[model samples]
Target: MTDWAAFTGFTGLVLVVLLSFAYVSRGVPHGDGASVSFDDNPDRETSLDGSRNDVELDGDELVSAATTENVVDGVSSTPIVPTPDSAAVSSDLPTHLLIANVAVSQALLGAFLALGAWYAEIPSAALGISAGDVPTKLGVGLALGLGLYAANRVGSSLSRQFGFTPDEALRESLTPESRAGWVLLLFVALPLIAGFEELLFRGALVGAVAVGFDVSPWLMAAVSSAAFGAGHSAQGRLGIVVTGLLGFVLAAAFVLTQSLLVVVVAHYLVNALEFVGNELFGW
Candidate 1:
């Protein structure tokens, strides 16, 4: 039988070195290299389709071309007012679905990693709907949450520094009902999902790799986090960067919390606040 333990340790160490090198290299100045930042502004550019011009201009509103809002002036003096071209709507609809597929792909990649570890006989490779070490598991979940949020801040800062707007994920559709569905999907899905992720990635993988290889715990954590980031490729370049940053945060959390207690709490709290806005209402 393959010494799965030894193999994992070796893999973890290799990943640590690779990711560390990449992380450091990012700081090195390449000739003519410029940093791009995230533009919180959703409407910085005009659509080439002249969609904005057609929109009922209310004092020349600078609109993002991505918006589905009707651009033709409702009160045009012309006998036949121009309507938003069907082509524009058709082109945009596909793009929206494409972005969503990307996000889903990243998430699935993470799941694949967990399954791989299980096949290798790695303990704690994944958290079953029920798993050992309940308190520890919860702590890990919290760590994942805070780690992700911190990663988000770092990635946004990097985006701003680089002067690039990360591609926004295409929303499925613009509808009150769809929006509500999305909210339910995330709020209802994320807590359990997040918990499972932490258990598998931070708790199991990190711990197994660390023990298997007899490497430094910190190194093991770092390697797992890098894998976490890479798994998020479907999120696009920006998503990968964000995942990488969060991976670092999770690594730190695992190391510090040691029991996964605080990690889960932190994770749950961050998700609730960021997505559900429950924290804002003191929930």
Candidate 2:
């Protein structure tokens, strides 16, 4: 068993999982609906206490119920404009089912990679398992993750501005709408995705391959980063480019620090914050 063997096995596993995911996602509906926003929320109302659900006075008594539309002083303030006719939101896809599928696939692939690496007897350091400046790595990773997330938002906006409105169909389709589903996303799905992707792309693809082949880590970073971007084809063409650039940055970080932990933390925060921001602020 050698580092090359581990890398080869890992790439094979990744190809299998990615191909399977692409095949399985063929039926996912494209998002014809525009991004949901606060202005679209019909239930919001302005009152003496500020904003909240609609409050109305009837016979000297205030009545309150879940609002169907915004109303004030015998007038309908917000019309319930319907969602787009072609919107995927009309479909009955379950977010939990999507999350479960992703979690299981990543978990299986990660487990296999781990087993292969262990059998290959790859040095722990080569695999980025050493306890190197734990606090600094964590801190920098967190900051990097936050910065990347902000940059991601800006990049997406710029893409849209340039007549390349990103097809967020895949993201919208997988978005969880319930508390329980959100819990699963933040705690289970996100961490696994970040960890497994960082392990495969940065650790094995860049680190191990570079070390074993006596190749420049930067070269491996480009190769691995390209694959990383292709792995996210579900996000559409623009998404592929954006994700690839982001992947290159992560790969470079791995090459520089030689610590997968930093990239993992950064990746996790980027994804976690993306979901949280979308769910809360509809960003």
Candidate 3:
């Protein structure tokens, strides 16, 4: 029998991922300039020839003895200074690409969240999880801890040829507030993130391939996980490889547990650790 459900899910996923990539490359709207504003009003209009009747200044008069016209020997003339308004305008010019990137990033994330709610049926209210459940939260934390350790170890080794150190690198990535933040994020934000990822990558993509290609669920899992890693290549070559490996782990978890819930929880835990460690400890 045709697995119509899986095929539909996979098609939806391809659309979502492509849109996300386009959005990230484009960035999002950061809003109008918040920098200083200029007031171009002058005290009085000065003559272009350098004469100002209000200031009693001679237009053509040479004020310095070293004026080029007054110089007896060969010398370069002093350069003319441009008006402040001209300089200000030049400096204040905005880059169109930068603005476009900002706009794209914001628009893309909004689109993804909306799609998740509309198509994936992830409840908006349930997006953020609670931290009150200590045992479950810690389990999530441990999964993240393991994933992070493994990823860091592998990533560090690969990047070591370029003089990067994993221990110091991980420490530098985390911050105190971010530590607290990720703890909350692990409990709250991670689930939401994991839910969407699983829906897109595992539930949608892997399921689709398994049905359409008449392949084993395991093979489908591997392919989908690989795609997930490739999506993160923007982080860097090594980061991409690490992310891909992480995706494999996630797929394996799903295969063993057969529960999207478990994999999502695990993914969230690992990401929380990574984000927190980077922000708090500077690793």
Best by TM-score: 2
- Highest lDDT: give the candidate number: 2
Go through the candidates in order and give the clash count of each.
26, 0, 33
- Point out the worst 10-residue segment of candidate 2 by lDDT: 75-84
TM-score of 2: 0.74
lDDT of 2 by residue, 64-177 (tens): 332212121111111000111212223443677666667777788888888878777777777677886999999989988888888777765665555444454555555677
The regions of model 1 sitting more than 4 angstroms off are 1-163, 170-184, 261-272, 277-283
lDDT of each: 0.43, 0.65, 0.43
RMSD of 1: 13.2
Give the Å shift of residue 233 in candidate 3: 3.0
CA shift of 58, model 2, Å:
48
For every model shown, what is its TM-score relative to the native structure? 0.46, 0.74, 0.49
Q: In model 3, what lDDT does residue 53 have?
A: 39
Ranking by TM-score: 2, 3, 1
Q: How would you encode candidate 1's per-residue C-alpha lDDT over 1-283 as one tens digit per residue? A: 3356654554454344434433432321111122122335434323322123223433335343332232221111110000112232234444334334323432454455556555676544322223457866665665565565555445544654655443222111111135644554354444444554565556666665566556687886777666766543323444454555555676677666464454545655554444333223311
Q: Model 3: per-residue lDDT, tens digit, 210-229?
A: 54455687887777766775
